[model samples]
Target chain A: MDRSMFVSISYFLTHLGLIFFMYPTDIIASTDEAYWIPITLGIIIHFIFLSIYMKGLSYFPRKNIIMIYLSHGKIIAWIFLLPVAIYLIMIIIITIRSYSEIITIVFLSNTPLWAIMFLLVLVATYLSSRGLDSILRSSLLLAILFLPLTLFVCFVSFQNVDWRYIFPLTTNDFRFITKPSYLMSYFSIGGVFLFIGFIQPLFTYKPKKILYTVLLLVPFWIISVYIPILTFGNSTVPHFYFPFVEAVDSIDINWLMFDRVTVFFLLSLITFIILFLSLILWMFMQIITTCIPKFRPNYLLILISFISFVCCLFIPDWKDVEDLFLINSPFRFFCLLIVPPSLLILGIRSKRKEKLENG
Target chain B: MGNTMIKVFFLLCIVLTSTGCWNNKDINHRLLPAVVGISKNGDKYKLILELPVLESDNMKIQIIKATGKSIADAVDWLSMNMDRGVDLFHVKLIVLDKQFAKQGLTDVMSGLMRSREVAPNAQMAICNEDLDYFFGNVQKSKPPTGDYLLDFFEKDAGWTPNIALTRVWQVYRSLHSSTRDVIIPIIQTGKLTEVEHIGSAVIKNGKMVSQISPNDTLLYNAFDGQGTQGIVEVMDLATVLILSDWKSNKSMIINEKPFMKSQLNLKVTILETKGNPSMDLIKKDLSTLITNRFHRMLTITQKKQADILGLGQTFRTKLPRAKLKNWREKYYPILKLDFQVNVDIQNEGFLKSD
Candidate 1:
């Protein structure tokens, strides 16, 4: 469980790949002509809330989030944990399909979607079954390997930046930005829920090391959002199907050995996304294993994989996938905001009460 | 052991299947279209894909030409003839003939933007003569022609400043905007057979309304600072100061009548002084003289109401709640633009040529 902090942090970063789906170019394009404000606002709000999530982590040290929740009371925790468990599964299912969708559309257009999903799920299930430790080790390996490629794509794209498009960087529609729904979308740090399980172990580490690790992640988030704006301009950026991939695609080093960089980056990024899927799947499995302690985790893994397969088969289209994601997003945010904060307050209060009685 | 063998078989399949890309094309086989020229012949749009054909002798020096379709129904119609696939992934320049540009090019513009193949950053331009001529002759000068043209549009050389490096995506944005305006560089090859970027063409409602020369483009770019570099010849000066960098500011005022003031500041470094102009004394003199000259240039750009600097967008972003409905009608017409050039003779080469 102490080693789970390492897994929790890796799981946290893996789930950060959820930003891929959240970068909805279609929604952004339809609503706003320029994407700079929303992306900038999203990053700033993300930074603020990511810090909050990391802070919340310290309160729960080393145990799985469900363990911490159980301390509150079976009845209240069950009510709360049910929605969180559902949300985690839903994220896993959506992430599974989104990756399949990208690989199918961009690279393997002729390949069957089921085949892609099956291949991805097989890898994820194996990783999840290995338990969190190996998954975290692989994730750290992936992070070390892929970070340079991501940065290289961004740097290469800088040469192609047409600043004229972003110039006169003004929009008269403050009302559009101030909309409650938009701000909600801006604060959608979807994967920070994984951190609830992390706080327990991370608390043992020095505050400075934790802060430094978090600070390192800040630039990655900024660069992730920033490159798309610089490459596609604010207005056109939203039109891209996958704005990040499209952003990388726009980087054409005429002299470079590679011609279509987006394709290369997309293929490489899929591995990271698979790791992302594995994190969510791991969390879902953890909930099941904890709730039904007598059931073997291997049998549970098969059941989860089967359920995910069925979900992928029926989700039907991007529109349906999007609808499910949208419907689930607010509910998921509700789970993230309410569950951990509530547990922290209640658990601490109960602890204080017991201490007083003993005294 | 049976279960272990089955699991091992599945793992092997996953590893083998996901390793190599099935559709990946080698760089050599793929025809990378750097400049896609589309022209309108009657109702049909002729698609000309200028793809690089690497030389058998040297990779650096390559040949480029149109793959197919002298007059295809659409640009995508020409994709059938290519071996691997024609991708505009590196397409930095989209050249339109003057005649094609004169007629509304909304369809071709939309086609380039909508197609996933065409890059969003690929610049849009209008050539004075046949675009084929420009594409053909571009390589004849020195290095590989396609790369040379790409460099020109890339603004690596500080030669063509203010030649609005408007991309296909930018055109889509401008066309969709309420203003219904966009700017594209107007290029004309000189008598010496060298490509000369003359100025920028202003389009209103997808039709060419006015043209601003390269000198005026300098003033426009200085205000916009697309980080574009170009040489601006001060009124009577024999030499031109290469503008390395530029900065601009704009404001909207709500008085009796709404007005916008735009200021463009250019940092001009002396590239060469042709006549015996004292480097020490004339440097100060040139700064004042250029400032006045730049002001005159801005006065013309303002009168023309070329929003290349995106003053309209600035207002839209900064003061989102403000009523900007009639910016073109009321504010832009009466908008005042001021230009100030600060000249510094950074490198005065050995023996100032007189």
Candidate 2:
């Protein structure tokens, strides 16, 4: 049974959740005018790699990414996926640490950070161990409950935007491409597409459908960065760490009982992030269990989550969180840039070998 | 049996989590301040918070004050002393003393940005008097404590074009922006009323450089394309209220020396006229009056070299992005304005005919 609809919905949710946090700050810090240039370029690169990743996976029907890699040789699989495994763990540690810090600052100032981290890890581990079916079903339910509210927040985020800030539509400097901040924006893009390769036979998805998904995503990417610039120009956008969060906070709808719509917007995004964490954990388990087949999988899941929780506890402050992102960017490029085209080549070779044998 | 075990575990978590004070706390045990004030004396900073205690639905405010080296330090001192935790989430207003406004707010503003304890959208104003005096007098005229001082600038409540309704984020933007400056309303305690909005304090490059009369603030608001419906009392011809929005045309020429032409258009309803004057005559007199106000505003902004009118924003299209960094200094000084005003009379009152 294929759950492509559910897979696509979760893919959209994960990407949307990641965009609002740090992507806007990085994009704005990278360029002054015509932000669309950098944003579109990033998406084009992501689209090319994603199309390749999916096409490569399609060569081996009904098999996940780890299994497909291991079919060649255990050394080959381990060599390719050890960094993938490390990057996945880094993603968990950073996301958990950073999001918990945000929650403490935003609404729960009195609470200890460890408690929030524990709660997040516990909930994410519960669904991760329940397996992919539970993850997919819960995501469908989450999108149904939270999608409308999210769409409503996105619409109202423009309430404070000044179209005048959209002036100087074209700027001369595309040197933003070489800046470290520009590549950091890719961290947001690479995360949501990785799971697409992992969800394989359980949910049959078309690579070309990523074009439609990206078309739908263009407005979100634009709004996430542009809302801050359009509300408070490029000069002012750099002052914020999460410019989109502040932009959403600037929206004033008095008739609503809630004093801050940011709280509501954040609550929904946090749920999406949790759903994403489960998927990442599930992916991590799939990789490790394939490498060492003797260990019981459920206990392994609990152990990885425990290690993640302890690692999150060690991040001293927000500055360390940012430094960790800089360190992770290299792994991100390897996973996003190198792995895809290489996989497609491998798939082509495997297919040619099979045809020769049959003939 | 497994289902019941899961049920008990969930209930136990709720029971254990409810007792934690770090985040989840009872409303009665938490302090939600509506307005926070900051002023500096010598090397120390004084932080003022107006907390509204809910006494059986009838609301009133309690004033709390602390002194420290920074905002966080002051808050720490105060929070340590109080039984309840302080939450800046509901803060609707932040008032800075005149002295604090001059000394520059970049440090304090960035501190707020980094911590993000307070929402950047909170309405901000400069107090003409001491903050202690301002809040002490403010308490005597208390109405409801939850959003007491916020009503003075809330667009729906007491806001008029004469009052420059600036926010923390706008001020922070002005601090960083190369060409744009923000004006925040300057307020003082009133004798008959609760508080009086005197005028607006012009903030340039993160510091208060000059003050403009409230009339000029109305023009500033209209130029920014907000609160354009403010009433204007023109001398000897008529008293008219702006009935339509602002329609402006600005053209910038970027030669060796950049120059600009600015046009202001307003449609007004004739509330009172001197006599049965010709429509053309009335329009001419109104045009002259508005042109004169614009001239006064321009003379002040140009002389001070502060781009409070946001003319630089219009010229952003004319300058390259790299050259825009020095816009206020290099370009703004040598820039010239060819100003024009156009007034359209929408209608006459019942008693008058042209």
Candidate 3:
């Protein structure tokens, strides 16, 4: 089987699952009764943004986003690449810290934070070292196996869901969804890490398969976020730090082998997220390799991993990690708003210039 | 190259072993405590664990009770005796015997919430019966002990509406929050020593003050659909009506005072009716009667200040700025309610007089 197909499929599925896996925790803070508005808002905006991403992808078919910038010549590309590099590093740091905190809270209460971060970083480095193609391929395998399991677990979880909390759909306070800029933060956050670099290589697969990949992702997003809201109610869901994991916690499988589903789901979802973070790092390494050709990709992986491991140590707890993600979300949004459109425009202009030269 | 690979493999093995898996909890040896009943035994508290024991190839039930100043220490006492690891992850039902529930459950509840293993959605109950009999009556057709209890709480029965599915998380929130008090399902075994869900115990400030029967439980859940459904009988002079397919919508309104209006909208697929009545007349009369009864029930809820209807939450949302300082004091007592019953009494089935 071709590895490229795996990466292409994985890239789409992982990107879809990763977005849900990243921020669906916001639904947990939606109290038992007050959870509906943000959930509705999340569903609407996810589709809108997904469409925008597809449109953006359409603009530049066979070129990496950075190369589109470089088409403007070395000067503008260098300026744009500087912020892009910083933003990528910041995202890696936050992902490491967040993953570390999850392990500490759920599975490893006794384990040191640095140890958890180290273990994850080690796996991440190995996956990232395999390059973007392998990372994407692995993601595809992981998604193919896990997405169905996730859906199965979700279907099984419907047994315990009390629909009462969801009724009388009303927004208690708009502040939960909007105030402090949470809506913008929630809509266009985290998943854009995939759109960073090596775009030209990604679309090597057939375009026809891309829609199927995106279609496969819609259920993952809806089930992960909306199911929690439906079960917990808007009032109660927002209180949980990790809503999807909390949704698994609500599973009361009477005679199932495993008593608590939280542990099982967390272990599996964390595996997918680790693959995702690794892909981000691998893609970032690919970008750096583009910049400095002499630096071996393996060395870049180790370098990013070391830096991420060290950064995870600095964060005291999950709250600080959340605060960091919330505060730096604007930077991530800037990447979304700027990177694609800028590259598309540059790609268009470069195309026109080439046509004129050919004429 | 083969030698180097072997050396690396050994090194990886060492590292793997060194990084101990904290979550490696053995299921066979682990004593799974399903429902824990904590009650006051004079000054100290009595902690009861319903453990599933395997003896002579047949599963047996074990009740272990320990007295301690706090819940954690009480569990510590059980830990000393148990041969295996005591895990509460499977602990779904927690019943506080009436004496403990009435005096206060603040201390016991806080401890349950503190444990990381305890599930947030664990169904909590309060009972007036002796904790020992309650334990004896917890027999099930299922082999594993907890499976029977799990099905017991989750079963669709006539009195299930009166049983509040209170989780540890909800208990913690209600205990801390000013908006709403906690309501726990009241379980009482019948004369045959079979477990029966009698009603619900309403707790204010961790103390069980009042109880509501199954019919009133349906009335309460009409606003909040958290519990199971069965037949509800509402009769007038002419005919006896069996109300099935019960569903209701609850809304919070903040006018001069924050009041929650609940519309118990049910598609009354009437199972059986005694009187030979026309469907249209039955619908109209039933609608009016339901409107009156539900209106009275709402008044009663308003009078009791049972904000389980989430009137405080409504005010907190719709009128955030004008939200009362204390929902219990300002809004709950003076709140006005409107009840509208749109009973779509469907055509009679087998019971219809042709």
Which candidate has the top score in TM-score? Answer: 2
Reference contacts preserved by each model: 0.15, 0.58, 0.17
Instruction: Encode model 2's per-residue lDDT on A3-87: one tens digit a residue.
Output: 7777778888888889998899889888878999999898888888888888888888888878877888888787789888889
lDDT tens per residue, model 1, A237-288? 6556666666666554656777577775665567777776776777787777
| lDDT of the candidates, in the order given | 0.62, 0.83, 0.64
Q: Which of 2 and 3 is ahead in lDDT?
A: 2
- For candidate 3, lDDT tens digit of each residue in A1-359? 23446645555544544554545765444333444456556555544554554555555666676666676688988877777777677777887788777777776776777767777777777777656666766776777777676666767767545553344456456666544435333532445434534545454544445445555565666567666665555544555566667667766665677767666666667777677677678667766888888976565567768877887788887678778776666666666556656655665676688799999
Per residue, candidate 1 scores C-alpha lDDT tens digits across B1-354 of 744764786688688767645556678766676766766667656566665565676434333343223333343354454455555666667888788888977766666655555666677888888866765666455655546566777655534566677767667666545433567888876676467788888775466657777766666665555564566554344355554655555555656344444444445555555556665555556667656655665455456664545565556543432345455555666666454445665555555444
- The best candidate by lDDT is 2
Docking quality class, candidate 2: acceptable
Q: Which candidate, 2 or 3, would have the higher TM-score against the true structure?
A: 2
Cα RMSD (Å) per model?
A: 5.3, 2.8, 5.8
- Candidate that beats the other on DockQ, 1 or 2, i.e. the better one: 2
Candidates in order, TM-scores: namely 0.79, 0.92, 0.76
Every model's DockQ: 0.18, 0.49, 0.19
Tens digits of per-residue lDDT for model 2 on B9-104? 545654665455554667776788889999998878899999877688887778999999999899888878999877777788999999999998
- The best-first sequence of candidates by lDDT reads 2, 3, 1
